[model samples]
Target: MAVDKDTVAGIAKLARIKVDDAEQEALTKELSNILGWIDELGELDTEGVQPMTSVVEVQHSLRKDVIKDGDRQDDILKNAPESKQGYFVVPRVVE
Candidate 1:
């Protein structure tokens, strides 16, 4: 993929990056090389390859779902700087 100066400038503008005139040329070449590498990778053939999350298989420990309200209102309110009636008190914002 050939990336021109105008294309690089457009990309920089869209990404909110300020690239100086001299740096823009270098950035355009670097970006083109990176895209070329990606294009080269697309040519490789990989058939029947299973996608893996990790190199080694791992079993995630999961707890059984049990219904409970974990209602420790007083405990939760203890950490609050200002609490009222088992709830954190915040300044009224309604106008």
Candidate 2:
């Protein structure tokens, strides 16, 4: 986890980040510490723990699927600027 300035620069180049020389030292130390922390986490004991996707359990309340005719064609066409034969009339797209 001991990241040097050269390693930091190489990492920045690989990640397509433009890290200046002044900031590289700070970034190197920060990234190295983060990796070290992740390494420290590997020492934790959780052999019997069940893997959970989320901390809170959620229940989705859903209504029964019912099918019905949504009859609103005439009502909808009433507000149109131009409608003919139960359809909206628009200018022809092709000549």
Candidate 3:
């Protein structure tokens, strides 16, 4: 699970990140430590453990789907500085 400088450099190139020699050396050690920690987790015994999304139980309430058009055109237009029929009026940008 050891990470060398060349591997770090290759990873940096793939990720499109600029990693100098000093940064590559530092990242190599950091990545090696992370891989070592992951290897340590692989040694844990969990034969009968069930996979869980969360530590606590969650229940979602279901509601009936209703589709209706909101007829509040005046209410929405009140926020606009200028509305020509029912649309916002903007200054012409094109010549």
What tens digits encode model 1's per-residue C-alpha lDDT throughout 45-74?
A: 778877677987788789889977777887
Tens-digit per-residue lDDT, 19-78, candidate 2: 998899899889989888888767889899888887878886898788775788999999
**Clash totals for all models, in order?**
0, 0, 0
Local accuracy of candidate 3 as per-residue lDDT tens digits, 24-76: 98999999999988888678897899888788677877977886768899999
lDDT leader: 3
RMSD to native for every prediction?
A: 8.7, 12.7, 9.7
Worst 10 residues of 3 by lDDT: 52-61
Any idea what lDDT model 3 has? 0.90
Q: Which stretches of candidate 1 lie over 4 Å from their true place?
A: 44-95
- Of candidate 1, the 10-residue stretch with the lowest lDDT total is 41-50
Report lDDT (Cα) of residue 72, candidate 3.
Answer: 90
Any runs in candidate 3 off by more than 4 Å, and if so which? 13-16, 62-95
> Which run of 10 residues does model 2 get worst, by summed lDDT?
60-69
Model 3 C-alpha RMSD to native: 9.7
TM-score of 3: 0.46
